[model samples]
Target: MTGIDETFAGRKGQASATPGAANVPPAATGARPSETRGVHPDAVAAIMAATHGDPFAVLGPHEVGPGVWEVRAVLPEAKSATLLTGGKRIPFERRHPEGFFVARVETQGRPLYELAVEDWDGSERTRHDPYGFGPSLEQHDIDALREVGSNVTYRILGAQAKAVDGIQGFRFAVWAPNARRVSVVGDFNAWDGRRHPMRLWQNGGVWELFIPGLKAGAHYKFELRGPDGSLLPLKADPVAFAAQKPPETASVLQGTSTPAWHDEKWMATRGEKDPRHVPISIYEVHLGSWARVAEEGNRYLTYKELADRLIPYVKEMGFTHIEMLPITEFPFDGSWGYQPVSLFAPTSRFGTPDDFAAFVDAAHEAGIGIMLDWVPGHFPLDAHGLGQFDGTHLYEHADPRQGFHQDWGTYIYNFGRTEVSTFLAANARFWLEHYHLDGLRVDAVASMLYLDYSRRQGEWIPNRYGGNENLDAIEFLRKTNEATYTHAPGTLTVAEESTSWPGVSHPTYTGGLGFGFKWNMGWMHDTLNFVSKETIHRRYHHHDLTFGLLYAFSENFVLPLSHDEVVHGKGSLLGKMPGDRWQKFANLRAYFGFMWGHPGKKLLFMGGEFGQEKEWNHNQSLDWHLLDDAHHRGVKDLVRDLNHLYLNVPALHARDTEAAGFQWLVADDQDNSVIAWARKGREAGEVAVVVSNFTPVVREGYRIGVPEAGFYREAINSDAERYGGSNVGNMGGVRAEAVPSHGQSHSITLTIPPLATTIFVRED
Candidate 1:
């Protein structure tokens, strides 16, 4: 006697002998000597070792003889076991020293029963055998899992809490094609692998089990044995809907209850309007460090708190949308959600999934959209994650050159694999459909588009065409975009691609990548470089400001001053200016005006609006106290006015993606370091003139061409005294004269303020 038999005695008719065996005859005990004769030896051995691929075939109820029914169970912690069925209790005979129990009944058919067992410590309980339930997934689910573009995988797989045969419990499923055995282990079963082995669906390589007594909120993980019978680490579910707070790596079961959504008006009309033709000014945020409760040990605010506080702030600031960094479950805090491990689970550091949904709903109710910075690029190789899942390179590439990211020290997904690609494509649909998110700004797209990205020669692998392009990744991206657009109509999908890949924001039917918007990385880099120089030196770099227009309308663009520009020792946007304290503030205000007046959408990271003097720190709150200074406060006010003007004026947004929307009136004025441009709307007589003086000397009576002759009101002036600038400008408005200049029939002579950008709209 080794395990359960070591404490409890065995009967005479039982197969295994123990310390206290009752010497009763077969007739007296109503038992036969051949009760365990028909059981297979190999099946018993496999069940004892927890390596049985199909535990249901041998562990559940079965017929051992013509009229004899047998119920078998592996209760390793039990001292005694009894089978209760049809209002009768039959004591089980110990079949092995390792706690294998079997009970034989002379019934006509296999009987349904429950196991009433006493643990080694004298605690007694009864449980419905997990193996008694049949497969919970249908044939259609298997087909969908195997299909290439199916977006229903999240609904089919993972721990789904449902009732099967009227028994309320959870049905667990995971894809591990090469695993020798897989089991559902949790606190309910004492984390025992042999207690609940899953049934294997060979069609999709998915292992499923229906635990009859399980409930939601229970933590669990899959215990797997590789194909070679070697036990691997406990792996977290890739499709887990929720997970334990970081540092404790267990997947929490969130039942099938969906959060109540009350954003009917936002959802109903979202798809009717095109984003390119609307005013879209986004406020990028990193939720964790944006604000914290300093009194309570500097803890991150809950999602509800954010909804209560952050939403109102964004609405007041006149931003149309709030773009948050990745909220997916991850292990490291410093990685900032970029190296995510659980793609499906929203990080538990915030409240539950339902709490996050409420936050989005709150934003929508406030007339603001929510966008997530989605990362489908690379994943960290953390133990208990997707790395070496099933003891093989199942989700990632096997070769280091193709599968590994040397720069990030992470594993790259093998987009060539059908299952892997399908998994990622379905994940994109999951967030958009399940959470009612307004948009997804795909991150690190440049890394996905190139095979030799950040790699030197001879250190990388080429595509099948012997080129640097990743063909499979390109196809996967195309498929993902197509699926999202088809399923979640009206939702935006923006790409953070930095290279010159043609037509990145164009239609897929025209051989484009099919992103709704692409970040204007070239404009950000060039404009930042030019503005960082002294005003006297700006003449040589004037092309940097004018060059972006050559391809501005090539794709729909969003001018982003994202968090990447401020962190990693790169200094703050205000600190990047080369001048005195007053001049630095003026330059930032001027650049913001320039960015807002340009021919694209706008996005500004948090703290940039108020001109935070210090660099962004993910571990601490933003320097919000800087707003106490009048200079910083003025910048914030300027941003608010810029957003409102951009929203109210159609000429600034209506034709943003069309070349006809913009015309340069002073593109070659490098010597004066002054440039002017005219913006036009779709309709006639809707036009605005913009002028910028990069130097510190105000130009008196500077002439700017205009398409229409009328009263041009100064809609916004970065040099206004209210924005901490020298109070110099055209008093109220400028009247266009008949003087022809810069190929236009009308022109306006105005006083251009120093280190400022001013906009004048024609009053129709």
Candidate 2:
């Protein structure tokens, strides 16, 4: 074996760079363009010999001596030198072609020779080739690896059966190869694992312990000690079914997570699956305050109570889907369900896992789909739970460089670990299988896709030359999407990604992140900003509303007024309007109409459709009293009609059909702030033209284009006096021009109301 060695002459003479040293010519600079500097002939010969004429190859970096190292890795097509690490090879789905570098390594000593590799472009990075050397097998490195890898002896030895099945009165076992003593601590034993020292069975380096009298639903953790009398802290079972509060013990819930569908026969009644026509109106609600603890008490709204009270309310609202905030068990009450502790457990605050399943089933019976908010990118820093799970690094990396996240103040899972991956991927499948939920809305996905997502330099590790391609996280996300789709092909998974991470909603096979739809955060921000501006300002940025339409075709999109926009001083959607209360209501109605009119799926927060005046407070009930007001009543009516129009309009729901069948018949932002558009469909008389005016002045004869040349009638108007606005809408029908112009469009001069939206349809 070759050992790294340095001589006094070599180190003291050529290695030391003089403080004022300038460029000095060597014997031969012929390898100029490639090396950029003179390299020793022997060094060149050694590299070429090591890689066998593969001039592009470089030995990847490895720990050689104290603060020294040699780099060895084949940079087949890299643009620069790459960091390398020890990790299992996994197939990755590629979205855009980019070079992937392994993690950086910090070594002890200087190496005898240094190797550098470079490539012109990212064309050479592929799974079919190797780019770097395996991890160094130095003693310290091996010890570190063994420390992390050995912590989960139960993973390989199969004591995880206890975590899956639970251990009281049941056979529970785990193997800790490095531990001399093992104890099972869990809810079954009142969390006292020491009273019952687990029987230690050793087979080679594998150490096993089996405990009896544990039952499913029993929360469990392990207590281990090495031969050196070093005690390992309590550790959660890797495959727990249930988990203890916030940061401690994992729960081993009884029975399978799968539930038998009570409406199996009902599911077969659907003729053809059309997402557009499937009554897909989603009512986004927060469970904590949908109903409160007064009648339900601090005891909380059980899944049964929500089914009893909420199903009718949702069905009455004409919503066909219910999108819940993150229901996973979270510790902080103030968080709008973002800080999740347990990946598998539905928030116990809402009820048990089975209860959540019943709620989903109840909704299914009521002809509604349920979508859960899933947060997997970051986890809370809970010492009792996932953090330091096995005394040593188990689920996460030991090195602070690999484990911590500064932005979230939480520990991100080492997605590169196979078991960690399986845990996450299985959680995604578990929700779908157990609850029969139709979809999931993945939260904070931008954090999961990038290494430098929210990190500042010196706080985070970098690739060799200090680039920020988070290869592991990217691979994890890819695998997660693929596995989720594989498990349930039609199940919808939406991404709440803010960054322009390409193909987040693309299929997994194509190297995309594989989500069904991405929340149109861009549209939400731009539209909110534009609408909040004065009428004149809207004209200048009218294109802001239309900008998303360009790349919107690449992925399915959902325009959402999510919880983020409602809380923390952002204010409610109605509160964001630029005019009076009436104008505010009208503007909101117009915006919703426009949102539905745009080519995307739509979601309204719990209080949005009804015009709740107050911002969303997670702890309290929505201002249901607002519905009693005459002003808010019109908003509710408009929302109901919007849902009806969405259901009726074929142009709205045709798969992947967005603004293509639409045209801006009129957009004179100055003319009383009126704008109009039409949606065309094959059904001859099914077209609808929408006209809106922001000014209080009613126009007696505002000419707007119609798709057909015939008698046009007002279908719905937001300004009816009984509902709310100034009651300035035209009471009678307006006849269209005899001949059509501008692509079969007919202009009609009719009375239009200010601060109101009107839909005029052709009379058949």
TM-score of each: 0.94, 0.72
Error of 1 at 650 (Å): 1.0
Residue range with the least summed lDDT across 10 consecutive positions in model 1? 17-26
Q: What lDDT is reached at residue 463 by model 2?
A: 55
Per-candidate local distance difference test: 0.86, 0.60
What does the lDDT read for residue 206 in candidate 2?
A: 26
- Tens-place lDDT per residue, model 1, 421-510, is 889989998888888888999999999999999999997898878999988888888888888888898988999999999989988889
Candidate 2, residue 442: the lDDT equals 90
Once fitted onto the true fold, the runs of candidate 2 whose alpha carbons sit more than 4 angstroms away are: 1-182, 195-219, 224-239, 243-252, 257-260, 266-279, 295-299, 397-402, 462-467, 655-659, 667-672, 681-686, 709-713, 732-735, 741-743, 761-763
